[model samples]
Target: MSERKYQPTWDSIVTHPTPKWFRDAKFGIYTHWGPYSVPAWGENTTWYSYAMYREADENNNPAYHHHLREYGHPSEHGYTEFLPEFTGEKFDADEWAEIFAGSGAKFAGPCAIHHDGYALWDSKVNHRNSMNFGPGRNFVAEQEKAFRAKGLKFATTFHHAFNWFWFPVWNKEMDCGKPENQGPGKFYPKFHEEHAMPDKEYHEWWLGQTKEIIDQYAPDLIWFDFGVFSLMEKYRKEFMSYYYSKEAEWNKEVIVTFKEIAVGQMLGNKSTQFTFAPGTGIMDYEKGKLNNLTDNMWITDTTIDSRSGWGYVRESGYKSPERLIHNLVDRVSKNGSLLLNVGPRPDGSIPEEAQYCLNEMGKWLE
Candidate 1:
């Protein structure tokens, strides 16, 4: 492998340096879509699986009440039920590529696997994936080919690190995460208390999935979600080195992004800290922005639908194109890039509102 340049050490890994392509390409687009899109419910639709199983919180989560009214009950109609509904019948990979390219995005891709344990790729590691169940589509592979054909650098986002705590499997009464319900050996899912630290096997599967994504897709960028902060230092080091090693073979610079400074129970783990030391990779702000410009490369992932969730619902409160343009300009002015997110419907159609916004942005950019 052309002499692996990075060892699994922060000191060694930090030297791998941010790529100029990322710095110059000031805008990108990625998606938060999957079976969760089927329900098209919840304020934070991406977390519907988790919220559907819980009692109404202090804020009165709409997904919980919505589940009761629409889907019957989490005990009977769980997240798994949505898999069949996520047929993606209208999912046109080439059409999606055209829409993203029209948005003036430089890089684009899928969320791949969000906090939902369900994967969109044909996964050998997780049996409960898109190919075996759900829409029966290899979303990552489809998008990679189409996006690259459209002259867009492909990126994939992984939020599955928190899949360990995503579902309350310990409840016992719910069929959602029950051992038998998950099918044959329970499919490498974590069965732990919300606050518990996952065991060694779960951590191994986490790394295995990351490697699978790396080897299979060879994406230009990999943006990790906040769940990564909960990972142990060794897994973090290993994945970074493993991804960086691809630089020589791919003949293109690759980027791995980490969130800035997450400490304490932000990941719902109490009495311990899991902080990501920044400056090791590209810094990312999730639904946040910086007040001042900086020399180091940074990115902000904000949703295109201004109201509601990252995953699509029936109705979207799309940001006006002018607002999106200004936000992009502001981030670019501050030496950071904007990774705008779009939540396509379960049928794989980009919302007309989102399409108009992107079209307007594209025209303005032109």
Candidate 2:
């Protein structure tokens, strides 16, 4: 193999091309399965746990009332308690991989860690992970093996970067601020009122988690949620540099997907906000689509049932299979990949409605 010419710097990394395999594949599958799936109750979004904790009105707030009635208050029975119910007893990694392969997806994986701070794999940095608390299994490793066995490229999504701010760290009513709360601080670190931004220690922990995922799984693709732009600049660059360097070491063309956050959204600092220059990697649009054909390749990550929620809901409405198929065709025509998402139940079973849609897409492909 020829020597890698690109360094870890943004200018050098920009020279690296998007892998041909990704551009040609045009479709992939990823799941949003996590501890949040246990409650399986949220509005249309995946921020149910946060909402349940923040909302005080049990009368109007369904998630809040549900949590209070079912799992007790957020102060006493925090989100960490959901870990026990997250036992993936019925989870079949091979079966999920087979479904993805049968659906004509070229790549498939799980969101290794969500903003909920629950790591799917056996994480060394955080004890509040699937292996230790919930499933007692390395879910990511199982999925990776299954994906590769079916000739599919493995990928992993990381939303942990946003966990620092996603939860109500300052809310004294929640377990986050209570020093007596045992696991809440580990999962939901107490925020310093003086410093609105994450401290150096938190940034290092974030980077370490990313590195741990990369070193352990060697995912072909790493997808980031929107809040990553708010992360520290040095940490962002360090992660990208380390990831790209690892790709070179393994002699593989790895891809990193990031969403562009608009100005004045989260941090209001454009200079500090992370934005990928053209050709750095892939650009992802969450629950969004483009109007015109883009010269640069991109991706659209929409859920099978956009109305219910991305995780799981007691009663959810789903988009029709025909609509999803049409969206897939339109995206492919515009040089974009469709990374369709499906939320599995807490028991680790893919909803029948999601399965129906995937099967329909497979038939359309055939």
Which lDDT values do the candidates have, in the order given?
A: 0.83, 0.80
Candidate 2, 113: how far from true, in Å? 0.6
Q: What are the runs in model 2 whose C-alpha is more than 4 Å off? A: 1-5, 56-62, 182-186, 267-273, 306-308
Q: What is candidate 2's TM-score against the reference? A: 0.92
- Indicate the residue-level lDDT of 191 in model 1: 58
Off by over 4 Å in 1: 57-59, 183-190, 265-275
Per-residue lDDT of 1-366 in model 2, one digit per residue for the tens?
124455556887776778888988899999989888877876643677777777767656677887778878788888877778887888999999988998889999998888877788888888778877777999999999999999999999888877777667667788866655434436666566634877787788788888998898898998888776656666776777778878667888788988866534554544533455556788888877889988999998988886748887768878898999898998999899999888988888898888888988898898
Q: Residue pairs in steric clash, candidate 1?
A: none
lDDT string, candidate 1, 100-158, tens digits: 99988999999988887778899898777889887778999999999999999999998
User: How do all models score by TM-score?
Assistant: 0.94, 0.92
lDDT of 2 at 85: 86
Summed backbone clashes in each candidate are 0, 0
lDDT assessment of candidate 2: 0.80
Q: So what's the TM-score on candidate 1?
A: 0.94
